[model samples]
Target: MSIPQKLFSEFLGTALLLAIVIGSGIMGERLAGANEAIALVVNTLSTIGGLYILIEVFGPISGAHFNPVVSAVMAYRGLLPRASLPAYVVAQLAGAVVGAWIAHAMFDVSILQLSMKVRSGTGQWFAEVVATAGLLLVILRAPAARVAAMVAAYIGSAYFFTASTSFANPAAAVGRMFTESFAGIAPASVPGFVGAQLVGAALAVAISSVFAGAPVATEIEPKPNV
Candidate 1:
């Protein structure tokens, strides 16, 4: 595919993913009526389904990389062209913001607002690291056809297991900063989350390289896990 086409896929996929995330959070929060656990469960299930569908829909066109870390890893492994990394990252970031705005619009909320939800601390950062590392490991190791299912399943599980609720994607962390909702993350907290995610991604890459006995050699890469 051409660079423009690939970028569009990345943008659209990311936008829809964020919409599913933020929109569901809003809906779930309202419907759960003070039940935080119930709201999270609803949000988690919707995200799992949305993520699986988006990956399957766009993976063939652009590898469905909606996360900057995933694009970076793919480029490092030579699955994606190094020159295209910037475009992919930009697309994902732009799509993320747009997605958040779209979600806010759908729910008749203020658009372009920053999150006030302060998610910080050692345990949260460490949880992000573990979540992101586990995510990358699953993506790197899953069979091509099973990438979507495995990734969605992992994120679903991580939602409950991780302290940060597993905002494992840097683009996702950035996106969530635009909403002041249940799934939102404070803008001030984004840097720490992103930093932890990058570290986790690096660790995953190193482990994958070692397990493969070298850098991955496949020309066709699997879909990015969230």
Candidate 2:
């Protein structure tokens, strides 16, 4: 796929992600007695299901990296083209903002209320770090380990088990700020979370950097048939 088209697919996937994440959160709130944790897990699972489908749909085209961290790690593994970074990030973030707005409109929430996090602070930050690191680890290690679906499943399960809740795409972090919702992160906290995810991604890269020059293609050239 062309660069613009790939980025456009990423954007649509991200927009869909926020809509599902936040929209499900709102649904869970009403059904489960405003149980924030329950709501988050429900929404997280919804995202996992959505991403599983999205990965299949867009993975062949753009690598379906809705998260900047995922894209960065792919670059680190020498799987992605460098020039695609800026456009990919921009598209992902813009889509997230649009998604957040759509969720708020559907749920009738205000920005301040939307940005109000049910979870935050130091512990949450640690959770964010670990969760993101784990997610990137899964993605990077998946194909080689022959466990792609397992990795995606790991992400969903971790979000359910981890305190951080969102394990948000770094780009999605920027986009989610436009509205106040269960899935939205506060604008004040975006910088810290974004930094954490990037750091986590970098750390993942370092951990696997020893294999930096490892051969990626498994296909071998055929010798002369003669």
Candidate 3:
């Protein structure tokens, strides 16, 4: 694919991902009333479905990496050109913010609001580390054909298991910071979450190197322009 096509793919995929996450959270919260658990279930189910579809649709175009950590890992492993890393990260981050705005527009909420939801502390941070690490592990090790399903499934599971509800993606953390909705994480909390996520990503790289042997070639690998 051409550079423009690749960037657009990444931007659109990441934007839609945030839209699914934030939009579903809003819808779920409104429909579930005071039942937070029910709301969470709804959010998780929507995310799982949306994430799967996005990966399948965009993987062939841009590797469907909506997260900076994933992009960085791919760059590190030479799956993606190191020279392209900055552009990829910028695209993803911009997409995330736009996605949050899109969700707000859909729900008729304030588009410029900042998240006030506090997500902090040692347990939550630790959970983020674990959540991010596990996510990278799955991405690195899962077969190409099964990656989309496996990733969605892992995220759904991590939603309940992790204390921070598994905001494992730094782009996601940044995006959610823009929303005051159910899925939102306060700006104050973002740095810690991002830091923990980076740690988790590094850990995953180390662990996968030992256990997964060489990186498994996948359908998501970027193809050269014809």
Q: What is the TM-score of each candidate against the true structure?
A: 0.93, 0.83, 0.94
Top TM-score hit: 3
Residues 1-226, candidate 3, lDDT per residue (tens digit)? 9889999999999999999999999999999999999999999999999999999999999999999999999999999999999999999999999999999999999999899999999999999999999999999999989999999999999999999999899999999999999999999999999999999999999999897556565634788999
* Worst 10-residue lDDT window, candidate 1: 213-222
The per-model lDDT (C-alpha) reads 0.94, 0.73, 0.96
**After superposing candidate 2, which stretches have Cα over 4 Å from the reference?**
108-114, 144-148, 166-168, 210-226
Worst 10 residues of 3 by lDDT: 212-221
Clashing pairs in 2: 114-180, 114-181, 115-180
Candidate 1 vs candidate 3, lDDT winner: 3
Kindly report which residue stretches of model 1 are placed more than 4 angstroms away from their true locations once superposed: 213-226
- List clash counts for every candidate, in order: 0, 3, 0
Per lDDT, the best of the predicted structures is 3
TM-score of 3: 0.94
Model 2 TM-score is 0.83
Tens digit of lDDT per residue, candidate 1, span 43-108? 999999999999999999999889999999999989999999999999999999999999999999
